[model samples]
Target chain A: MKILVCIKQVPDMESRFKANSQGVWFEETDLAFRMNEYDEYAVEQAVQLKEQLGDAPEVTVLSIGPDRVVEAIKKALAMGCDRGVHVQDPAAATRDPWQIASIIASHAGDKGYDLILTGMQSQDRGSAQVGVTVAEELGYACATTLVGFAFSDGTVTAKRELEGGIKGVVRLRTPALVTCQLGLNVPRYPTLPNIMKAKKKEIQTIAVAELLKEEPLATTVSFHPPARKGGGIVLEGDVGVLVDQLLGILKDKTAVLR
Target chain B: MKALLIGEYRQGKLLDSTFELFGFAAQLGGETAFLLVGDETRLPACDGPLYLAEAAECGEYNPDLHKQLILQAVARENPDFIVFVHSSYGWDLAPRVAARLKAAQVSEVIGLTDGGFEVGCCNAKMRRTVKPSTARAVLTIQAGAFPARQPNGTPRIQRLAATGNGGLEFVGYEPAEAKDVDLTRAEVIVSAGRGVGKKENVPVIAALARALGGELGASRPVVDAGWIEHSHQVGTTGQTVSPRLYVACGISGAIQHLAGMKKSDFIVAINKDKDAPIGEIADVLVVADVMQFVPALTARLQR
Candidate 1:
């Protein structure tokens, strides 16, 4: 089995963000980058499957971004993926989900991947569209927000998350795609030996222009900080007084006490 | 413009969020049609034509068959926009439909403006106004962002058949585990976050919740760390709650967490870091340590 796990490099959520001059995306300067938290689960699932299958499956991790994205791809490599593919796109931040999905499908379409895995959504765009869109583009059977997964006899059985904590069990034959959700698995930390091994692993680079076949279907009119909804009074001084002040405000304003 | 609103049906009834889609369609200002993939009993009352797919044929959900029914609806209605409430069903189906139609797609739209639709970008730290360049677009409206609007007048119902099926099959549905605490019904929620230190400290916050006559709520991390049950989680993937009074103890509000509880009538965030995003929407920012302050607050409340 050939497994392809798609990952994305997102700016650290803790970083201070500012819109670029064009007002389309956040500024890159002074920002630290890391693999999207959700994608970590995807990588871990793929590696675990490879281990279970006992070398029958070859796992390749793919990511699309500028040079910094190589770091993310390498992290997946350190997690036990066989190789990495970086589709270098400097303007990746500006591309909408449709364009990004199209690019990924274009590259992975002819690769004969038996299964594809991706995070439920990217942290930056939060579009949650790419995995399903890629599956549609490739005409692969797809499922999303999966928390449990098992494969046997060319059939994949996945436990997907539904609204209000319901779980739906879905089954699909190989040549399928599934999106990993949070709490799916605990991702392994890269050991020092694996880190050194990942440094030597091959990272095949492809230019985004070569893979992209469609124009952006959507445009960002503007991007800016969200407006505050008011009411941010800070209670100060001693902890005792602060608790007293908070209780007083809650009693006066809310019916919780009553 | 012609619009098609897809309604979600579960547990033998249409979800209330279906009405929220009606609310958005009214705002879009055009002829609106409703689509639900279920039997006649699952149909929602709407002013426009309603398309009902046979539930016996579709089962719980076959993504391919449902997508085909939606395509048939689009072909018959010629809708310029297809709308779905941003839920699990929409999250999985809308993108497939959009890709097939070659339409522009946007997810998690929080608001509509004269310029275009507003969605959160950069992890909800910023908002982006997006305009679809294509004539057709698929959109998923954010849950709770739009109010529920009941459409007036009778609706013409159209029956749809399952014409096609991709290889994907629905096996079954596992009901959620029995939950002892329903956060939705709680008037007051004292939620803990990673800042509470560890699992041992969760009882401190629970004590505070008891003092306030409320239930204990928790962020995703706390739940993921096994500090509490998943039923008590408050977030996009966990639960969307709007309690009367929400006390976020040591919770730095992530966007998903905010989406779940931001609608609370009164929010008070207690975090040692005063700059936490929770403070932005909080009515009061109680800057203090979660360990020390929660006990004191519980003591004061009990007295």
Candidate 2:
């Protein structure tokens, strides 16, 4: 079985993000980057699926971004993916979901992969729309935020996350897409052997111009940074003193005792 | 201008985020119509005209079929704006709808501005105000960002053609076998994050919850670590809660965690780092070690 796992390198979530001095977008330069947390689950799931399948399940990890974003594709390679595809697009940083998915679908749709996997949402955009769009663009069935899935014959049984902790199971035929959520599987750290091998794996680079249509479907009108919350009163003191103050306030003004 | 709000339902009941779309339509300030594409069933109440489409496979969410049903509805209605909740369902369907319509989308929107809306970006470390370029645009509004517009009275409903089921099939949900505590109804939530340090330390936090006479809640990391039950997870992808008081212990308040509990009436965040984002909404920020503070607070409350 062949699988395609989509990964993205996003600015470190722990870093202090600052808006671009002139625009609404974040200052991308000088920020640390990592593979999206959710996609880590996707990569891990792909690896596990390969292990379960017994054969060297030809797993290819794909990413779209500037040249720097190839690091994420390599990270997936280090995690045991067979190869990598970097759809080089510098503008991917600000491109809308439709555009990005369209570019990916063009390549992935014709590739005849048995399955396509991606993170439910990106840590940066957090749109959770790209995988679904890519599925639609590819004329394939798709599921989102799936926590549990199993492959059998030509169909897959999947468990989905709904609001309020409800889990639902669904069946979809092969050539399907799934956007993975957290808790699906613990992503493994790349071992020394795998990390060395990752440096040797071939990453095929494709230009965005060859895949994108003449005009993007969507365009951003303008961007401005959102207002920060006026952090409320911050109490200062020792841990015990702070607890005393919090308890007094909770007891008097809130429902701590109630 | 006419704005169409697509409603998503599971097991014959509309999701809570469905109503929140009404708030988006209201904010758009125009003829707001609620659209539901599924089996031939009655739709949830709407303040504006409700458009219903009965489809063969509309029982559950089939991204392929649902997008087609929405496209038909959009073509018939020619709405200026098509709105959806930024829930999993919306995230699954909206972009395809936008792609088919050849329209633009502004997703994960948190606030409405004069010309457009604001979306959280960079892990909610910052927000970006965006205006769509398309005359007819699509949107996925963030959950809990906008209040649901209460249904005024009997909504004027209209039915559309039945769209057939697509390549996908609907399989019923397997509710987590665990008898999970629903946090939505909790009066007070004493929530813990990874800062509690270890699995053995969870009970101290639980003791604080018990002392407060409240339910125990946990962030995604703690629950994923098996430090707490998955049912106790309170975050964007978990159970959303709006308790009267939310005591956050050691949680740095990631956007996902905030998405679940920010609606609480009063927030008390106890984190070792004072610079955590939870302090923004926190009624009182107690900067201290959670391991030390939770026990002290529990003792004080019990005393």
Candidate 3:
């Protein structure tokens, strides 16, 4: 079984992010970078699948970003991917998920990998579009928000999370794509020996112009922090007094209205 | 502006958010028609023209079949905008539809504005007003954000079977191991966060919920910590609720949690940190320790 897992290197969400002067994206110089949280689950899932299959099923990790993204690829390789494909371009930052999906599809289309996996969304963009778009472009079946995944009998049985607390079991054709959601699995830290081997792991870098030969679909106008929300009226003095105040309001305001 | 509103039905009934999308489509103005694919025998009455399709394989929502169904409907309706109520289904299918039609796509729009739309970016830290490059678009709306319109008029229903080759099978739905707690119908919810401190302290919070005769909810942290079931979790990946009153205890509201419960009619946030994002929308911001405040509040309510 051949599997392709797509990963993205994003600014650590915990870091204080400030938009650049143009307000188009974050000021990269000050922030730390890591694999998007959900993508780590995707990478972990791929490794676990390889271990479970045990007949030497290969897992290939793919990512597209600026030159710095190779570090994320190396981490995936350290974790256990056979090789890495880096679609490197300094300008890829400005491309929306539509364009990003196009680039991924260009590489993934002919590969005919049995299964393709990606994070539900990028930490920076959070559009949750690229994987589905890539699946659509390649004309493969797909399911998103996949919390449960197992491969058997030439088909993938997946548990998809739905609104409310419902979980649907979807069986897709073998050549399918599923987006990894949080809590799907715990990502393992790469061992020191694997980390050493990751140094020699081949990373094939492709230019963005070489993959996607089209104008960007959406142009960014600016990047800025959203309007700060403050001015919340806080009840002060005593906890008991605040409780009294809340009870009075709930009895008068909400209890009757509903 | 002709807008095609994609309607959703679950468990033999039309979802309320379907009407919410209709309301949003109405606000977008122009000819707003409704589209339904798969077994929609219990289809809600629609105000505008209805393009309805029924296919046997559409039971549990396979993205491949849904994409084909939506594309077939788009070919028939050919509206300027395709609207979806942001759900697991919307997140999966909308982008694919946008690709098929080359429509500019926007997901989770809180409001439609002039020139573009106002979207929550930077993890709800900032709202960006964006203008799409194309006039036509595929849109997935935040559930419960728009008011649902009452359906009225001579319902013109067009029965069209969406293209499905029956290659995929929806093997039915499996309810999570925990008893399913439907948060959407919860009129009042007592939600806790990491600030509840520890696993043992959750009962003290649940006491408030039981006292108030409301359901118990939790932020992602509580559920993720295995302190509570995922059935109680509220957020983008969890359940979206619009209870009449929401008591957020020890919850410094993250934008993701806000997405699930911001629509509640009244929100009371009790976090020690008054600067928490939850306070921004909280009607009553109580700057008190939840450990102290919640017990007192629960005692009073129980009294």
Best by TM-score: 1
RMSD of 3: 4.5
Give the poorly placed runs of model 2, Cα more than 4 Å off. Answer: A219-225, A228-231, A236-241, A255-258, B38-49, B55-57, B151-157, B180-188, B197-204, B207-215, B235-245, B254-256, B259-265, B272-275, B288-303
lDDT of 2 by residue, A11-122 (tens): 8765766667666467887899899999999999999999988956799999998999888888899999999999999878678777788888888867899899999989
Return whichever of 1 and 2 wins on DockQ.
1
Candidate ranking under lDDT, highest first, comes to 1, 2, 3
Model 3 scores a TM of 0.84
lDDT string, candidate 1, B99-201, tens digits:
9999999899989988889998665667889999999999999987888998876789988888656778888889877777789988889999988999999
In model 1, what lDDT does residue B52 have?
87
After TM-score superposition, the amount by which residue A34's alpha carbon in candidate 3 deviates from its true location, in angstroms, is 2.2
> What DockQ does each candidate score versus the true complex, computed on alpha carbons?
0.67, 0.57, 0.43
Give residue B263's error in model 2 in angstroms: 5.2
Per-residue lDDT, model 2, residue A120, is 93
Fnat of all models, as shown: 0.84, 0.68, 0.52
Sorted into a CAPRI-style docking class, model 1 comes out as medium
Each candidate: RMSD = 2.5, 3.1, 4.5
Model 2's alpha-carbon lDDT is 0.81
The residue-by-residue lDDT of candidate 2 on B18-114, one tens digit each, is 8788777667787777788654455666666677765444556776767776777777778988998887678778877887777878888887777
Question: lDDT (0-100) at residue B130 of candidate 3?
Answer: 57
How do the residues A149-191 of candidate 3 rate in per-residue lDDT, one tens digit apiece? 8887778888887766578887888788889987777789999
